[model samples]
Target: MATDLRVSLTDRCNLRCTYCMPEAGLQWLAKPDLLTDDEVVRLVRIAVTQLGVTEVRFTGGEPLLRPGLPGVLERCAALRPRPRISLTTNGIGLHRTAKTLRTAGLDRVNVSLDTLRPEVFRTLTRRDRHRDVLEGLAAAHAAGLTPVKVNTVLMPGLNADEAPELLAWALDLGYQLRFIEQMPLDAQHGWRREELVTAEDILRRLGERFTLTPEGSARRGSAPAERWLVDGGPGTVGVIASVTRPFCRACDRTRLTADGQVRNCLFAREETDLRTALRSGEPDEALADLWRAAMWGKKASPDLDAPAFVQPDRPMSAIGG
Candidate 1:
């Protein structure tokens, strides 16, 4: 059963992160083609009421780019057995919107921060919004977004050496930091297995600074990050390890693009067009059936380790990472 749904609010992003997109010439979806606030609410209602979805995460090229996001959060909060609402963002705009989003019933947030150094941040993202991201982290904590996670994608020669420093910074500020193994979702399609910084390498580096203990088998089902206690303290750090250690067996999440397509997996080659069905006056129960059937046919796992593994056509930004 698909108990979680990642809803892409828009495909328009402000930053040109190296892994997500090129610096320019990106084609964005037209306003009319994207789902309206009411349409998103309707699909979410069906997912929660019929399909037993208990969590809904708002993702995007940048979800904060959507003007009506707070209203969408409010509507999702009104549902019976209100699902947990979260957002995955770049944190560039959170400084201005975090309080409003929290007040509108957002439960938590995960912000993407790849590096702490200003120069490296500029090199990776092609933007100088490092100070803005730091402020956004502070604002999120002030707004009471518990467990404000910082997601850092570890590149082999870039920012990989800062693993311990990044964890210490997050720990000092009472935030959870997760180092993600780079997957083949870049716009350039230049990813290679040898370039990945594995979880074992990260743990080893982190262990040199802090006393760490694995939180083995206590992780929540379907949760992507494997956690570790930091120095027997309150803070914890996580490693996604997507490339080295695939977690597809217990995956229970599905995705809804801003254009209304249903994606069963992040790496799925095919998508079901739910927007057309929704616009064609299909009954709510029928739409629910379509969603369930789509997820039911999902493959046991995405073959990321196969020698013939091919990168998906859409990059991470378009896929709502």
Candidate 2:
């Protein structure tokens, strides 16, 4: 059973990253369709108490954008056999809420910082908030969110050349750096396989400036990122090569969208609705059984290289990853 659950707080985002969505932005989810704070906390309580979920990661178009985020974290923290809670955010307003979130029981964070150069950052995210991200990162660290992980996606013509520089910056600051291959999850559906910066390409480029020794599969386990010891020391870097190298067989994650739908896989087309049952006054056991059936029917790991493969209808933002 999947003990790690990724729950999307909202599909709304503050940034317009070129790789994520267009400058015009996506059609935001209606508030009425979204799970209320009480509903969210109740589902989480069931997942921890009735189900065997051990880790809970709050995601979003950007999780920090959710106004009731801190309260949700507080409730999850109060679970009997408390689940380890984390958030994945764009680091936009983190500087303002990092301390409050920490106090509300957030364990740590995985922030997106694709580039260090302000000009490049603006060009990529279509936002002039690079300094804000830096400040947010500092605030997160100051608030005791240790092992601050930085997620970077290298686009072909955009920030791909900055891989080594990005890793060096992370090493200097003791941040765990991860380079992700751009996937077919963009809202525009214009993602071309040939345009992606492959994992092998990232390794080759980084190899020019650093010596990276593979930490091996035994240590990697089910985590998407394949880690490497940077310069043969404690500081390390990781590559989430989801396209060329899929680790779905070892995947132990379950996803819940903001609207209370369960997605067995990140690329799955099918969604099982939990909100309706909850709204209809279904018992907690019924909801748990519905969740179990969804997982039990999870499709096989997607073979991106296959000709039959089709990109998921929903973008990454909507899917909670």
Q: After superposition, how far is residue 39 of candidate 1 from its true place, in Å?
A: 0.7
In model 2, the worst 10-residue window by lDDT is 299-308
Point out the worst 10-residue segment of candidate 1 by lDDT: 213-222
lDDT by residue (50-135, candidate 2, tens digit) is 88999999999988988899999999999989999999999999999999999999999999999999999999998899999999
After best superposition, candidate 1 residue 230: deviation in angstroms?
1.1
State each model's CA lDDT, in order.
Answer: 0.90, 0.93
Task: Give the per-residue lDDT of model 1 (tens digit) for 1-321.
Answer: 889899999998878888778888878888888999999999999999999999999999999999999999999999998999999999998999999999999999999999999999999999999999999999999999988999998776778899999999999999999999888887778788887789989998888889998887656467899988898867898889877789888788999999998999999888988889999999999999999899988976767778988888877787786
How well does each candidate superpose onto the true structure, as a TM-score? 0.97, 0.99
Instruction: Write down the lDDT that model 1 would get.
Output: 0.90
Query: On a 0 to 100 scale, what is the lDDT of residue 277 in model 2?
Result: 99
RMSD of 1: 1.1
